[model samples]
Target chain A: MSVSITVGAYGVAFGAAAVANGFTVVQACLLSLLTFSGASQFAVVGVIGAGGSAISAIATASLLGVRNALYGVIMAPHLKVKGLKRVVAAQITIDESTGVALGQEPRGIDAMRKGFWYTGIGVFVFWNLFTLAGALGAQAMGDVRAFGLDSAVPAAFLGLIWPRLTGNFERALAVGCALFAIAMTPILPAGLPIIATAFIAIAVGLKR
Target chain B: MTVQIMTTLWIATLGTSLIAFLLKYSGHSVPERWLSHPKVQRINALIPIALLSALVAVQSFSEKSQLVIDQRVVGLSVAIVALLLKAPFPIVVLSAAISSAAVYNWL
Candidate 1:
């Protein structure tokens, strides 16, 4: 609950930034409700806010979201969720739920599934609730740009992704991808450069 | 929002949602042996780092279709330093937003 709430509260920044970027409060809230992934949600607004086309925003967000699929694969056998429950399980298959599930490995599969459900539902509830709060707050602000809330999107993204850089290789890989994306920004279409960074990952992965 | 903007937003959100759902479903369906392949594992691990770095770059350095270095760069840099110092997530975001507003106002 603590982890989910604390992490979910950052949706407020996203809410404010989404509105600043021209997303209606309803659209912003819907993104949180449906998309449900922090990095991907931010990527959508980040790309769209910066004037990238919807196609580009979707492409960028989808690329970041590939991980959730991998999470599903890891949890599928353990979860054994079937029928309509499978759909629900898929919806909550994010980093926290998967992490909590995996972290309970020693306690056996039932405990792991329980951890996943608790964290997943906990985050979903809090994340959506707080997203509405943030959107409403940003809407009330009226011209969030005057407050320089536009910058919050990028900064919030930085905060979300920073802890993931746990090793020298990861840090170097991130910097290299960042440079490549920046260099390509002037030449490529708005969202293509970020998508292009997938090649960097493939190259790094192949080398590994 | 105009019809165009509304259409675009719906399309993007729904498209993204569909893609995410498909990926998750495939996870349930794909064979465990195929998933356990070393190459697949490596790509999965590295992809997030690459994508996020790219996002940070484009978000901070680009505005619309043009490349424009601005106060967002300053905000990201401060956020990075704070993150390295092990500041909490909310604080990192708060500090970065503050620094960004401050720099923009200063200019």
Candidate 2:
């Protein structure tokens, strides 16, 4: 499932996007290699390309980053680190792993540990390798839109999100978010549109 | 850009990894009492969806080059068609890819 998640979600779309921009294969690969954050990367790229100052890009990226902050603090006690190990542990705190790890029965287990690291590391490795490959391969990948690779991303998104639909509220929120995002893409700064749309989705959908 | 390319990538990767490890190290500290907290549940509801929406929408729609609206649109529509028909995932994706590639190359 992690592989499935990684391939469609991270590998194809983000990798492709990284390459589509002017990022060198090495740079793209390395970026994905270390920074496991997704939205922030997108935000950073969008901000930079929009003629935004470095501070704006960083600020937008960092603002989008606060979510992981909560993950860090919440997962703090479970980590049980007292030394250098604490530093290593702190690095991988992300939305996906945190969500999965936190949902588990035990606070800490070899299984949870493996799952957390493998999913993050595995996705990271694949994402970077493919991102570079995709970047270098962009000429080869030529005209992905025709093949509807464009649609694959949003469609793949549907796969991850659709399953979580538990009620009218969730469904409504998602639809609202999607529509809002589409409407706002040309207007808002890179990160602002989607965030605004999603929260709007939450607020509006939950209203009923 | 290169600096950001270097800094943002390194910082994000290392940061995420370290945070993940620390969280993993912490393991499970969710207070049983907090398990059913209304606030926690509400926050959880909006957080991922919000994040996921941002991530997916930005990556898909934001483009660097000319936004072509031909077979790419055709391919996408067909994919939506495939979804409506409940065809297999790979088939839909591959078929769409092939169609769009053909569109770009020939027309």
Question: Best candidate, TM-score-wise?
Answer: 1
- lDDT for each residue of candidate 1 in B26-107, tens digit (9 for 90 to 100): 7777787867778988897888788878888888888776788788877888888888898887777777878887888788
What TM-score fits each model? 0.93, 0.64
Off by over 4 Å in 1: none
lDDT of 2 by residue, B1-107 (tens): 66866565444434443443333343333343543455544655564455455444444455532222455455555666776676655555556566666776687
Off by over 4 Å in 2: A1-9, A38-67, A99-110, A139-153, A156-160, A185-192, A198-208, B1-41, B47-70, B78-96
Measured with C-alpha atoms, the lDDT of residue B89 in candidate 1 is 75
Compared with the true structure, model 2 gives a TM-score of: 0.64
Residue A183 of model 2, lDDT score: 65
RMSD of each: 1.8, 5.7
Residue-level lDDT tens digits of model 1 in A1-208: 4696576668788777777777888888888878888888888887776667888888878877878877888999998889999988998999899999999999998999999999989888888888888888888877554455666677777777677788999999999999998898888877788878888898879988
Number of backbone collisions per candidate = 0, 33
